[model samples]
Target chain A: MDKKKPKKVFVQGAIPPEKIANSVANHQSKTNIGAHSIFLGQVRADEVDGKTVTAIDYTAYEEMAENVFHEIREAAFAKFDITCAHIYHSLGKVNVGELCLFVFTSSAHRRIAIEATNFFVEEIKAKVPVFGKEIFEDETHQWKVNK
Target chain B: MKVTVKYFGLVAEAADKSEEVIELSEVLTASELKKQCLEGLAITDKDSVQIAVNQNLDDAITIKDGDEVALLPPFAGG
Candidate 1:
């Protein structure tokens, strides 16, 4: 596999569930992979004050974010013996209970795939220039900070 | 010298603009420029903001002509 090529990481709005299934089906031809680890991030309906979060309006420094995502992919490939890795994140409004982020990693063993997936998730949360605005049911909003 | 400054997320909302080009009469490091751009903004935690010069996160780097600078708020990705 060409590991150095940077893949598009951002998708508009919410990522469809069918995309995940299609991704899994596409990898069936690669017989060298024995395990696949997936991580899906869903928008949560958390109550703040008296209102509940209805959605998140995600935004990013797109140019910088793409670079950071590429860097994260390179680092993960260097640190783990993984067959492949794929990441997708939402760029616009994603409603509650909808998928916002998807991380998929495949490897010859289960441990490496799991570890690579975790690495991608943590790095993305810490390093990427993506931001989220939590919109409440009453149309009010607040900036979301990663803990 | 002039440099293009970009803002994202809360910073953009606070600034009311996504991008702007500023003319610098004196040399300023990335952090200094960040502060200048963010002056009077309503962002509560200015310390949590970060500056990126030419797509690399570094506050110590001095701003140069035609450089791309970005003001980034806290990341909330997964």
Candidate 2:
């Protein structure tokens, strides 16, 4: 069989809330999928040293990031009995309380969908080389590191 | 040999530029190249920095001419 084509995963800026709804609507035709799980990552308004974070400017080594994302997708499919999975991440600036990353998975059962979604989230966070610059309300900025 | 070096996140901020080219007479491991790049920069967390030679994040590999090297800081993706 031919290889499954990798979907484009990066959006220009903050991911719109309506995109989630659209994704679900698009999947309605796949009748065999009995369960779906979705994970959305929102930028938090974190306070650091008396400054409140207002937004995060995200950037990445795009070529490498895309390759890593494809690998993560392949690994998820290999490890789970999922029917399909979709992942979207934001580039550029994303304000606090806005969505930045979305992971959606579908399967014949709920357990597989949920587990696959979780795997994608963890792998993306640990392995992808995307960077974030937290801009404070006062306009000062600091680099963000995932703990 | 000339190599293209790219920087991202805090490393880019410290270096004051995103990418550049450096000419070298002898081959160097990714670690050695990263050290040279950070010599005059303001980066303090050397351990957190990783070097990718031609998109492969392995410092033990030898860098060659025209290869793309990236200095990546700690990943902060969600």
Best by TM-score: 1
Off by over 4 Å in 2: A1-3
Q: Across all candidates, what is each one's fraction of true contacts kept?
A: 0.92, 0.96
Docking outcome class, model 1: high
Please give, for residues A83-132, the per-residue lDDT of candidate 2 as tens digits: 88999999999999999999999999999999999999999999999999
In model 1 chain A, where is the ten-residue run with the lowest total lDDT? A59-68
Give the i-RMS of model 2 in Å.
Answer: 0.5
Q: TM-score, chain A, per candidate?
A: 0.99, 0.97
Q: Write the per-residue lDDT of candidate 1 for residues B9-70, one digit (tens) a residue.
A: 89999999999998999999999999999999999999999999999888999999999999
Model 1: how far is B74 from its true place, Å?
0.5
**Error of model 2, residue A113, in angstroms:** 0.5
DockQ, each predicted model: 0.90, 0.95
Estimate, for each residue in A30-96, the C-alpha lDDT of model 1 and write its tens digit.
Answer: 9999999999999999998888999999999888889899999999999999999999999999999
Give per-residue CA lDDT, model 2, range B1-78, as digits (tens).
Answer: 999999999999998999999998877899999999989888878889999988898899998888999999999998
